[model samples]
Target: MDKANADFTPIFDGQTLAGWHAVPRLPVSRAPGGPEPDRTTETYRRAAQTTGSWTVEDGALTGRQDPPGCGYGGYLLSDGVYGDFELLFEACPDWPADTGILVRASALGSQGYQILLDHRRSGNIGGIYGNGIGGFHGINFTIDAEYDEQGRPIGLRLEDPATTIEPMTPDKTALLNDAASGEQFLSIWRWNEWNEFQIRVEGALPKITVHINGVKMTEIDTAAMKHPSYRQDEVLALLGPQGHIAFEVHDNDPGMGDARWGPNAACRWRNIRIREL
Candidate 1:
């Protein structure tokens, strides 16, 4: 919102991406005589089979999702890792779906912070995903679902407590209470409409500030998170270098869950940008 700091520079001039490299999508191996194919393999195949589903149009980079295999997304990453930076972007999900902007990813999993764009009326919008303080940091919110032995949802946990004031699990895995504390941090926007998202990261101190539609929603202190893989110095060293920025299009095939109105339902995106601070 303020003038670019001395260490910051624009990565997208509102049209084409600058100071960033396009990590062209690559393909994964497929098994012989497999049933249909796994989602990851299909996703990588789509990326390799054609130019990415993303395109620069009308001063914005757009991501389009096609049916069949829910792959082909958008991403513009810095050539190097940045310990501190501010990322800004505007996105609009297709009539009935959601998407996410993932930062500090390890090319293995959603490790750092994810700005969620949920469209369902169920109130899962604008939440944070993956490693963060207080476990699953973001707007305090909860979903009712019963879990199987492996932690998979078997049915809605009707008796589950609200999500606020629930301390994160010791391993930083699950949210514990029923008070709805996490839901208080998000600013919900219109579904199927463009909304602005801002994320600020200070890698050294490992702090995060999230703003949605001009409303400051949550600020997380990573130092306080339950189970960290390393100490402050180690974390800083690992994250100090520039890393990849990615968009997560979770597997939403029909059998995975009720596909109606879920991420597999539909989704679109445009106008993505990031600046290194």
Candidate 2:
């Protein structure tokens, strides 16, 4: 309430998906070099045939892959575009769901700055990810989920080195200079419950800051950071000064031991409020 302190507005109506639309989740990882892949037509086609399901149930926006683990993913994006704003929302995802909140997103939901809400086994939350902008990860640690015999999520573990794919080295640490420790995040995060997320996105090339349950999680300055694959000029041109906000339902990879999204399970969102700066 304090950071995004005043003049807040509600983007979601709590009854329907009126001011939002669906789009296919596109490739967020691209190799450095060559002109950006123009997937406009492909994005449109996939959107028309989107297999993800979005609905408002009990006043909470719920999203899940249709037919439960059909390997399809999509994003529900706001119809209006915004620049330099503060967004607050509460999310409660089922175990094993790879989801996120995307800011500065293109119409097709291909490109954006993402706040990772990867609520799955050996996944992480509140991290900064470059969506279709070079695949840079700006986070200090990882989180792993513990499940009961019935396959329900029981608890969470912090910074499991064995499951880490991108370790925090000197370079990574320098790039993500304002990262919160894993223990700091774990101490505040409430498992299997509705957790509030507050995000501040500003500037042409944004400096994004994320807070979970009122605790600062991480901050990334795209304008100042450098990555092997990230091109600031290219991203600015592709996304422009303002764009839509989107929620993602990640594609299920059947090869993985568990579905990226659970079977018939949905991630719930509510109290989505925003304040434009």
Candidate 3:
């Protein structure tokens, strides 16, 4: 394989997690228990008896959740913090899963810019979302300003008044897509197919830009975005210019009788390499 010319570095060792840590899927409890279990056992307990695992297979960093777990998604975070960098990786999902590349995350939580990988029917492959920022938190994405009937952005700092967001065209130098469902955009992405994702983070508050299979999706000037749920000060705090990189291991919703966490959602990530700019 060719190198990124020494600017980029490979983080995953293809077989082990030497410099990574897994955050507790759920908060620690003071429940009545027998002789505080070991850290690993405590984690499974925190996961509400459901086992979500991150491991290396086929030279990739893979995260899996089984038993439709009882906790929220957990992150496998890097031990070090990063700021002003470009990250590239490939992700493949086999089912309806919510996956993200977390950059500039705060400590152990999802406080940062997320490259949303909600590859379901109505999900987007390349989009900027604020993690743990109220209205933006936990939702697929954030929307503050309303759109006109023609999808023209009503109010945004960087948007032009004449054009709507839809029908957006990238530079002719980039690849093209045909639909919003992500699958119709190109053959590069599909269930179980490896889709290359590239993310760039810059500026003091960080302007997030995303690309999938070499096509630009959209960009978010974090400091300039407005939303009803969170104030700019609140949102600004969540955008960590220096933080860890992580892969989210999703938790299954425990429901029964057709309301289950079924349809089995799972994703795989590989070739996770990054370079600071």
Candidate 4:
């Protein structure tokens, strides 16, 4: 990728990667209660155990597939945490893989908001995960009981869970909005090809804007998003200042025997970059 006409200045150019350190890879299987590995070794170990495959080449990061027992592929880091910043990166998955850009992550716990990148046929892409929440795939709404002039339940309603919930279509453009109100900020699609992702984080009010080949897809209201048994404020607080970014690859095919151990099923990431807003 060329550096010309770049919106965000290049912080760590691929030519001479400075301030970025290469984390080592570690063994997948370890005996119970074994002596813990060194820092770099442990980082690689945790990544392999969690995401399945990740590698670096020519100063660019890439993810690949390894057997389930070889460790899950992803990044496990003790660095790269920011608050109220903008993150820009390019991701292209070879197969159906779920990748994410995480911010304000907790160093000691799995508590934070993740901008998901999933390519499944289902409309589950570009949602928040973790921080005591499992999944909030798309914009969902619930309407309180309507009241008439006599304070009785009215017949008219809008955007209700029983009948008003709908998924926003994908558009390739930037969007901005006040998080307090549930507004359509962005539309996202898991394109078959590479797409540029722009994530703007303004403290607890994080917004996600996605574009594909210069076409606007979607903008999501991070603060207004809600899920069952989870509070947005609590998750944001736990994210703290900084944390590691990772990718998640899971075995979805259940027909094949030992599908988890099968080959030809893995995810990859490239051209990763972040700019502090």
Candidate 5:
């Protein structure tokens, strides 16, 4: 049974890569400027040149890539699995970079649910993305805002309208279009600065909610809908009970050899904490 208690604990020590593992990664088909897959965990650890990189600096957990855009970005997997819990962290991404948090994420190449971290004009931040299954299953739920240390709004972060090319239901696609024009979301996003990120997931596919700066951005109820593939339930089942939490450095051919891994590919995270409810 799931508990309702809230006792958060630190996971990363901020000094080492303990309790984390790097999964082997390579570029997807037809992507250029990306390296080949390392083939094994050991091989990934031993390679002089890493397609993706992870490090601890200034007490922050950082994941980085090079040459931006070209292929698939790398992933860092947790040593443990979690379900029906809340996660808190700070993420700062360089514009043009791609990143996200994977829940019940599988090491088998994007097989899980993702919380988008792309803050670009064509990206969806604080949105639902289907890993290995495809792209966004739902439209973005939060608006971007820029604030200062004093908790005052400085400005708003906005993404330009993007053409929909992913396989999505007509209704959902329309929803995305409407959302892009709606000022329903508030932006608290800051460039090259730390931003608070929180996620509350509970009740199996019961309820998943995402927040930025304590603002509710997106929510999903698994029982209310199903993926068209007829495997979303099965996949969620595989994730539930318990599954790994992960961070992704995305690498894909956005267009014309533009790498998902951009020049400022160093995405930093810190103050990791989690607790089961």
Candidate 6:
């Protein structure tokens, strides 16, 4: 596999996390009456638990909830902020792990646009989400798990068959384009295996594009985006033109039988390189 090549520079040293820091991550929203609970107190408590463990294993950067099955998660953030760049990385997440790559993230790490790597029931991958700006889901499909006889996840399936491509609607067409169909995505995706991901983000209200295993996933023009809770001006002010790149481990759901991260599960990432635009 060709790396970033001559035009890009490597960010991760492969031996150590020299330019990164860990921070507690939480779900947040900027919309009124949008489940934006007062988690400030909870956040303080969580920060004390752990920056959930981030370590280098087998040459890959791995992240997991400390002590596993714990309700909280964390983020590994780049020390420097970035703007208008293309990033390339490979990911291999354990089944049911809720993970993501964050772009233009705030110092705290949760406020940004996330490219979902939520490998679990009713989750979507290769989609854009408003991490803390509004919780907007810029996606058209959700992936679920297929189980073996003992109920261990053996493979994946689309939650809704119709979402295989999700027929283009006027509203969706206006916000995004060049999307890969669920069929197209599944055809190339290797279950329980490493997959390459490419993300390009540019401008303040950027146009975000994602490719998975060389398949064009989707493109979102934030400049023309329309969502009830997402205000371009407000998000721009909050995130600014530059922010840190972050790797996320989502908080475990407290509800009965709804685990976001599989017990002892971790997400592995490597070959992280970037090119400034």
Best by TM-score: 6
State every prediction's TM-score relative to the real structure: 0.59, 0.89, 0.68, 0.56, 0.74, 0.90
TM-score of 3: 0.68
- Across 12-64, the per-residue lDDT of candidate 5 in tens digits comes to 88999999987745432111122445556543343324446788989998887
Instruction: Give the worst 10-residue stretch by lDDT in candidate 4.
Output: 171-180
Best by lDDT: 6
lDDT of 4 by residue, 1-277 (tens): 2323365555444443343332323332122123444647644445534444445554545554455434344333324566665555666653334345455545532335566554322213344444323334442221223456996433222233344223343311112231211223223323344566655566555665543434433466657654454455545554544455444443333332222222444444445556666
Tens-digit lDDT string for candidate 6 (1-277): 2563788888898989999999887556664235665656775577556778899998899998886777678999999899999999999999879899999999979899999898877677898888888767777667888889998888887776554323323454345666777778888898999999999999998899999998889899887788878888888988999999999977775452335788788999998999999
What does the lDDT come to for candidate 2? 0.81
Query: Could you tell me how far off, in angstroms, the CA of residue 44 lies in candidate 6 after the best superposition?
Result: 5.4
Tell me the RMSD of model 4 versus the true structure: 13.0
lDDT value, candidate 4, whole model: 0.43
* Candidate 5 weakest ten by summed lDDT: 26-35
Candidate 6: the clashing residue pairs are none
Better of 3 and 6 by lDDT: 6
* Clash count in backbone of candidate 3: 0
lDDT (CA) for every model shown?
A: 0.48, 0.81, 0.58, 0.43, 0.62, 0.82
Q: Which of the two candidates, 3 or 4, achieves a greater TM-score against the reference?
A: 3
Q: Candidate 2's residue-wise lDDT over 141-227, tens digit each?
A: 777777789976697877467656445456655666587887898898888899999999989999999999988988889999999
- Candidates by TM-score, descending order: 6, 2, 5, 3, 1, 4
